[model samples]
Target: RGPQSQFTRAGVPAGFRSHPGSTHLNYMINFWSDRTPLHEAAFQGRLLHLRALIAQGFHVDTVTMDGVTPLHEACLGGRYACAKFLLDNGANAMAVSTDGATPLFNSCSSGSAACLKLILQHSASIHTTYQLASPIHEAAKKDHRECLELLLSRGAQIDLELPDVGTPLYSACMARAAACVEVLLYSGADVQIGCGPDSPLHAAVLGGGADVVHLLLDFGADGCRRNAEAKTPLDLSKPNSSVRAALLSRGPCSLSQLCRLRIRRSLGKSRLHRASSLFVPHSIKDFLLYQ
Candidate 1:
């Protein structure tokens, strides 16, 4: 007995044997899901049989086991036709898997400009927020400038914050994606937006992204700002002394010079307080002054 005979002889459910061709197709779908053929099909722009199978209900859009729909699979494989077929067959464009990933997110994350455009044209939300990672965040992380621009043009929120406090700008900065960072900043991402305990500057410092650090500084990122633990960007600097120096040496003044300026400012306030004390009437001063 072949595989089909065994499945039928084993008294599998009637649905299993009702349409053996569909059953075979379903099996192939699973195989394709694991080792995607949609990717190849999308690359080659041909998926006639796959489309017919989807039309015949062989390709279910609902999640099975991994919360991945056909759309997710198509996006993962970068198959634009498969994706279009899935979308036309009522596959939810905004469907997020158990991992909070959308087809658009995966497409952009994979750096497929064609797939990204297809999803965007089909009304995928550019500003769609996810639990941990987002399309823009993933694009920035991978330094896919074209994907990033595609998303931005579709109205992806440049400042969309992640659940763990990660932002697209922060991810771009951490990845040292200077082009992405420049695009995001030019598109109005808040440079001062802090993610969790680390600001974008802190992320750049920790990631040893000197160019990003400099770009952020030029955009008015305050290196002196501290995290939740009170660690400044300079404190976050690592083996890269160049990063440290670049961070410290902003605005024609070093961090040490800035510190001295702050100290002098404090001293000036103290002196003003002392002068106020000395000039007051004796009784009033005594009553107002606390020893």
Candidate 2:
């Protein structure tokens, strides 16, 4: 029997299939009818119901037509218990949906650091192999600082770039995610790497993010850099906008700031966290670590 028959056996009401000419109804039917009892329980965070369905012989890894597993639904909805239960039952954490979203990506999408941590721990490799489904970028763009921080701590490339999304820092700037932008900078993200030819400075200004524009400049972003449009961020800013003022306020990098950048670069992204254990004075250590 086919997947359709399996679902029908699972008590999805009959007659959901649309007539040959009704593609829209067919799509709607497939979207809703393919969801099983396990999917609903996981999505709604009904732990007992999810456990009951699993006890009733529903496979933990069973997926919908779009490849959304019960684990995917749980993570997408930020249901940590449901996700944990599914994972313990041997659900595939690295399972990519038809849309290229992993359970980790959905966890980040929901801004649940707990779910994200669980998925990361279960999956041994968190490489950028799934570039289209970057959990770090999703976290940064959504301003989930704790989630992004946890990913960075676990060896996520600080400057991981995607074909469509650029680096996580750029994505954060474009989204006006100020807290996330600061987190990325402190984590040693490159300020210059933006989406293709666009500059993160340009993105910050366009997003009306005056504070983020300043943050980028503090991290050594070049204000003179032009995007594909041949416009500097200042040119894109409104004449009297705070973003314009922030862009214009940047001067030559201070000597202390330059020293901080150099030292942080020497430490590199992976060893940056160790700066906290350095033997320097508290203020100097804070300065060096961007605290």
Candidate 3:
């Protein structure tokens, strides 16, 4: 029975296995509607109490009725210490809650860069698909710039588009997460890879984020691009609104801006960060890298 210990539960997730070839000892979990003290301790970031509970035989992988482990609670609460302790004690980092959210997603939702990094260290790869709500998408939508950057640095796809959520850039625009939009754009996310036909500029206009709309234009997002309803970003803007003003003022892509876009395209997404290494003036390198 190695790491598989049977525990009857009401809402256990589909997968309940431990890390393959793990050396840490796994304990059998007890489940009930009231849940375990580990969940409480982890959610509150009570490291001393969590340590005591684990020492007293509380399973590190113990879950609730919704398949939420203490690790999920810890990440959700931004409790890096408790989360670290759980992972060290054989807790599953990839455990999904009833809502299809992993601890990594929870960390993003909580805006905890530390917890996100800790969970990423435990997990092997980023979730490229829309599964588990996409930690990258969560970070972008929640305006957690640090968490989003960490995911991107760890190879999370920048332009990952979901059926409903669009790309991370679009989601950021829709959520009015201006900083995230800028970060995604800077990180080489496609401005055109929006949700279905709706572009990030369209989303920004509809969401009333003037700053975000401007950033999209600066990044070469096509304001004339129409959505499913045949409405351009300008068309989506409200009458007498700053969004409309920004979109209208952008007019055409400037010569300098076009050159910047062209250069970045030639550099490609993988090498965008390496632009600084190019033997050029500091200002030229900064301009190329969007620094």
Candidate 4:
């Protein structure tokens, strides 16, 4: 027999298929009818029920047909208590769903910074990529600045390049996430990193990110940088737009700015954060830290 017959044998109420046109009802039916009790508990954020199920010997890592474990559901929903319970019961933080999203990816995509921190403390790999996009890429694309910062502080690669989406900076620009773009830039992301017929500047222009365009220029982005189509970002900008004007007005970096950039680069990306604490004039410190 097929799955329907099996459900019948398992005492499922008859007429489950009676509402074929009711997608929402069918979804509810699937949620309750198909998911194991443990999976349902986590998805519903029922902390006490989850604990009881764990005490009754249900597996903490139980997954659905799509390979989404209980912990994945908890994190995806931003259920702190449910996630904490699941983690304490030995749920696997690294389990990937059928679509390649891990719990960390779900947490980042959902903008759950607390859940993200928990997963990171559990040794979730910041380098893990889902469809060629890392956790930071997911956070950046979704405009999850807190999650992005958490990932970066945990040693995520600032320049992680995706197959089609390019770098986290590009993703931030495409999403018009100004704060995320600032964090990535201060972390030493390459402002000129190319993304197909677009650099970060082009991505900002395409996303109508005038503020982001200004920020990029302030960080010494090359306005004249061309893409595969041989069109500079200025060429793609809208006529009479501030972004266009910003790009057009950009010029060569002065010697002082160049010296600051060189010193920051020589200090290494990880060590550049220390420049803020150095004993120097506040202006010099700002230049050193890319303020």
How many clashing pairs per prediction, in order?
Answer: 0, 0, 0, 0
lDDT of 2 by residue, 1-291 (tens): 024333467454343444566432222334453666777789899999989777755668876667888898999999999999999999999888777888888988999999988998896355646677888898999999999889888878878778878999888998999999999998788888898889889889989999999899988898988899898888899998999999778789999999988888899877888888898988988888776
Cα-based lDDT at residue 224, candidate 1: 86
In order, candidate lDDTs are: 0.67, 0.83, 0.82, 0.78
Supply candidate 4's per-residue lDDT for 161: 72
Query: In candidate 2, what residue range of length 10 has the lowest lDDT sum?
Result: 22-31
Best by TM-score: 3
Give the per-residue Cα lDDT of candidate 1 at 121. Answer: 78
Candidate scoring better on lDDT of 1 and 3:
3
**TM-score comparison, 2 vs 3, better candidate:** 3
Worst 10 residues of 3 by lDDT: 10-19
Predicted candidate 2: what Cα RMSD to the true structure? 6.6
Give the Cα-based TM-score of candidate 4 against the true structure. Answer: 0.83
lDDT of 3 at 28: 33
Tens-place lDDT per residue, model 1, 24-71, is 334332322232332234334467856654544444453443456667
* Cα lDDT tens digits for candidate 3, 1-291: 023333448323222334567633343334243446678789999999989777755668877656889899999999999999999999998887677888988899999999988888886356833364788989998999999999998888898888888889989999999999989999888888899999888889888999998898888998789899998887778998999999888677778889999999899999998899999999999888777
lDDT of 3: 0.82
Off by over 4 Å in 4: 1-34, 55-57, 277-279
Clashing pairs in 4: none
- The lDDT of model 1 is 0.67
TM-score of 3: 0.86
Ranking by lDDT: 2, 3, 4, 1
Candidate 4, 20: how far from true, in Å? 37
TM-score of each candidate structure, all chains considered together: 0.68, 0.85, 0.86, 0.83
Q: Which model is ahead, 1 or 4, in terms of lDDT? A: 4
Residues 1-291, candidate 4: write the lDDT tens digits: 013213357333232332655422122334433456566677678988888767755567765556778898888888878998888878898998778888898899889999998998898898874655368888987889999999888888888777687999999998899999998988888888847657898899888889999988877777887887898888888999887877777688888878876787787778877888888899999878765
